[model samples]
Target: MASYGNDKEDYLKRLRRIEGQVRGLQKMIDDDKYCIDILTQVSAVTRALQSFSLGLLDEHLAGCVVDAAAKGGPEADAKVREASEAIARLVRS
Candidate 1:
């Protein structure tokens, strides 16, 4: 029933990869790795997360928002507003 239901496995895979990157970061800290190297990995993880968020947002708009708009009612308006808020949050992040 969720917007991302179709691509749930893809999302989970991406999240798992990101999770591995985070664990690597922790190991880097434990090993006292170079500061710049650690920061680069941090940047990579941040970018990966941002990319994931954008993909999910696109799916929400394409699937959930589009479906709601097709129905033509208060739900449509709410979906659009909800999506707008999500975009704002993503932008702020």
Candidate 2:
């Protein structure tokens, strides 16, 4: 199992909520909801996902990445680059 540390419960709860939102979006699609309304919901879901990603990224940087960097090795640099690329992709999306 993955360890989310102190924010595990909160993160899981948020993820569940996001799942429900996605379900709701699916329902709206089935009901032929308005395009603007559907788009709004999509935007909300995207923002929520981004928020979750940011939280996890912050934790990774503070914990795993930092710890690795303190060791002053190639692995640490790789982690830093990986984290940077991940954030860039998130932002681009």
Candidate 3:
């Protein structure tokens, strides 16, 4: 099963909203809007994407990592390492 199968719909909903935001941003550019206004929308979109990423990461840790760790073996170690790497990448971003 997919790691975030349960949240798949919620994720898609958020992504669609973000997609709309992106389209709005494009429109703002085409209309020759103020720099600050366009930048404000850009920041909102960035933060929304970050929030979505954190939520998915949370689910991965809670569901996938926890289950793997419960199994107690090489799979558990790999999962922990994978989760740590994911966190590192998120932090860097």
Candidate of highest lDDT: 1
Candidate 1 per-residue lDDT over residues 4-66, each given as its tens digit: 998999999999999999999999999999999999999999999999999999999999999
Q: Residue-wise lDDT of candidate 2 within 54-87, one digit each (tens)? A: 9999988888888889997899999899899998
* Most TM-score-accurate candidate: 1
Candidate 2: stretches off by over 4 Å: 1-3
- List of clashing residue pairs for candidate 2: none
The deviation in Å at residue 72 for candidate 2 is: 1.0
**Superposed model 3: Cα runs more than 4 Å off:** none
Provide the lowest-lDDT 10-residue window in model 3. Answer: 1-10
What is the lDDT of every predicted structure here?
A: 0.97, 0.91, 0.95
Please give the lDDT score at residue 49 for candidate 1.
Answer: 99
TM-score of model 2 vs. true structure? 0.90
Model 3, CA-based lDDT: 0.95
Query: How many clashing residue pairs appear in each of the predictions shown?
Result: 0, 0, 0
Each model's RMSD to truth, in Å?
A: 0.7, 1.7, 1.0
C-alpha RMSD in Å of predicted model 2 compared with the true structure: 1.7
